[model samples]
Target: MNVKTEVKQIGLYINGKYVPSSSHRTFEVKNPATQGVIALVSEATEEDVNQACLAAREAFENGPWRTMSVAERCEKLRRMAEIILERKEEIAGLDAIDVGKPYHSTVQHEVPRAAHNIHFFADFVQMQGGETYPMEENFVNYTRYEPVGVAALITPWNVPFMLTTWKLGPCLAAGNTAVIKPAEMTPLSVSLLGEIAKEAGIPDGVVNVVHGLGSVVGTALTEHPAVDLVSFTGSTATGKRIMKNGADTLKKVSFELGGKAANIIFEDADLDKAIPGSIHAAFMNSGQVCLAGSRILVQRSIFAEFLERFTKAAMELKVGDPQNIDTKMGPLVSEQHYQKVTSYLEIAKEEKAKLICGGKRPELPEYLQKGYYLEPTVYVQENPKSRICQEEIFGPVVTLIPFDTEEEAIQIANDTEYGLNGVVWTENLQRAHRMSHSVRAGTIWVNCWFVRDLRAPFGGFKKSGVGREGGHHSLEFFTEAKNICIALK
Candidate 1:
């Protein structure tokens, strides 16, 4: 559980090389666990964004990366994955401090998952191929997939290490060069990827990392002329802004945006599993996850029993130092975000929802007093349209709603503008099928939560997101399709 207390400084990486910010300005990156300065990362200004874009463009247009054979690209990606695995502990430490994720979760899931994602894409792209069609006896038609050129990837702070690979894995696999802008609050772990790329022999300018506020560097990256596509993972509001900015260039924009997912438990379900499942879904990463099941819809038949068990499990969550392997939960990403989440608790009170457990911060030890912490919060509301039910709190908060029937549960689940993820807990095969078909979400976990297949399509519906990213879906997004026809006598 020991961590470094000394402050360090990090730099931006452009053209496969580390360089200071163009403006020579620096920003402080903090450990959300203790509110202590973790490192001073270069603050990438608009000019730095432009420089990174230029480097990416050069790499995509005339660099060896784009010209390399598919096998060669896969090999490089495997090397990078190996490097990531070898440094998993080191990376997990940074992730634990930077994002306030539990050390156990970071080391067990986030760190290893990132390395696996890269390897998945490396082999995934190799197995993927364009199709050839038989047109006529005298003619042949075929399809080719080409890189989308420069990609602008903007990752959020909550899952910086995982989401970076989520975008970069297939991006580089499909032969696109990129400039990533890690969230200002957590840039340390992502900035380290530049070194991993260099170690893997990923060519210069193939991958770039710029660290700064989203408004400055994010805007520049989205609007840059050389950028062909912009892939963003953050709030829905910011996703809308990126779409507007990239529209001028007619660039393709893919988003994995916000979600207020619903976890529906049927009366026939196993409460033993559903209780912990519901709690874990809502409180994972202190509820900073976009796909967090913030809404729990219970069948009216078992609503009382479910709420009692669910609240008990939520209240038992240990919220303290993320560095502790036994810690079940950690603080919010920052003081500002902590306020945003706590403000919603007041709204819940005003709306007259029953505050079952956790509307206040937990008492911490002396050394952790400065950390931004919030206890697991559960609210029971009869009205599905309540603000607490409708909005994305993006914290450890969940609103429990009761639904009369399967149809009502489906209606309540799909009632939101966001449809990123939905969960259904039912033992009946018929009910599971009906709920899965009826609830509108990119991912629906039946009898389980947060279980994922690397090859499955991952994204959202409605305003949750614009496109999917996983397996071949990601390769398609990062590349464009071209058709070629040949005529013979």
Candidate 2:
């Protein structure tokens, strides 16, 4: 497929206007697939971030959004979802180019999921209600949830559009205005939200976006006094920093952080499903996903067979231009990230792990040669405590460790500091139940990977994150509950 390499200028969307940064500075956003400058985005300074927070604060304090009826608010959310679906192709294209995600996956999966998030939350909020208590005949008590006010939403580069909507949906549904700082590496697709919000009849200053490096822009937003809540999705290290930054003001903070999830395959597992599912679990989005099951634990009985099939499948993944429909994997998001991921190859060698399939960059066409592409890598390690097994490489890398029994599998899986996500592949119902309960993670998948329901609580247990945000959990985080009692005559 022929892809356009048009260069556009993206500005900070503050209040209701698309304006340049206060410093009049801009940064280049390059396409990871072509190494070409796709856009020049505004570099938000502290002043720019403050303006966005002030805009959100002003809108939340005085605008009609907070006072709008639940039905009316939902209508606007539905309209935003509609616009997202209508421009799905355009938005998907931007993300594919900006984040180096496969266009097929973005257009067919992530974009639609982004729209679904808005729709689901809009519908969910309408059915949501508070508790009513009747104490005796003399008095009655009831609770109500109110918008918290200005929210600072910090999103990551991988799956930027979908994750932004994931946070934005509940924030807006609860009637809170927001200032968003999309990952500077992949800011193009999220830059469309400002226009989407306006066209959907959302009031000005209700949803503002500022783009810049996280150190400057993210810290400013988190530390802003006017901001009521901070919802962030990124590295665990950054999540910790945001916590400290917001500590002075005691801002309500929710984070969905990093993971090194364990995908365990029991001997009773169905390899037909496990092989492909495990491949997707490990290498989806070039393994840039926070939920990527980078550790695969196979029962020793089927270890050799699983290794053969898994390595073969990993080698067959198509790595090239993200615009190509057949391309299953694309380049890492940036040169810096490419370097970070490739460093793990050296780490694997230093750890004395067996190199199973891939650990080098693939030979691409002349145009894509300059892109940040790497082959999907797999390794077999005897020691589960190796650095390659413990740390999050955040790339297309997986470490396979052999285990003897379910007890050992559980032990190895829980050994990591991260408890974000895990996968259990087995047909035995009893074992599945046992493993599900034994694994120390937020969400455990049984014979499935990446399948989600909007109603379930989504967050990590340990170092993965601080709080949960999905369904009622999301509403709980975005709103403040108050109780009012009345005395009967």
Query: Evaluated with lDDT, which candidate comes out highest?
Result: 2
Encode model 2's per-residue lDDT on 370-419: one tens digit a residue: 89988999999989999989999999999999999899999999999999
Deviation (Å) of 166 in candidate 1: 0.9
> TM-score of every model?
0.98, 0.99
What lDDT does each candidate get? 0.90, 0.94
* Model 1 Cα lDDT, one tens digit per residue, 1-489: 666868878899998888999889998988887888988889988888888999999988899999899999989999999999898888888888889898878988897899988999999999887898876688888999999999998999999998899899999999999899899998888988888998999999999999888888888889999999999999999999999999999999889998999999999999889888888899999999888889999998898888888888888888999888679999999989989999998899899999999988799999888898988988999999999999999999899999988888888998999999999999999989988988899999998999989899999999999989888888889999999998877
Root-mean-square deviation (CA) per prediction = 1.0, 0.8
- Candidate 1's C-alpha runs over 4 A off are none
Error of 1 at 277 (Å): 0.9
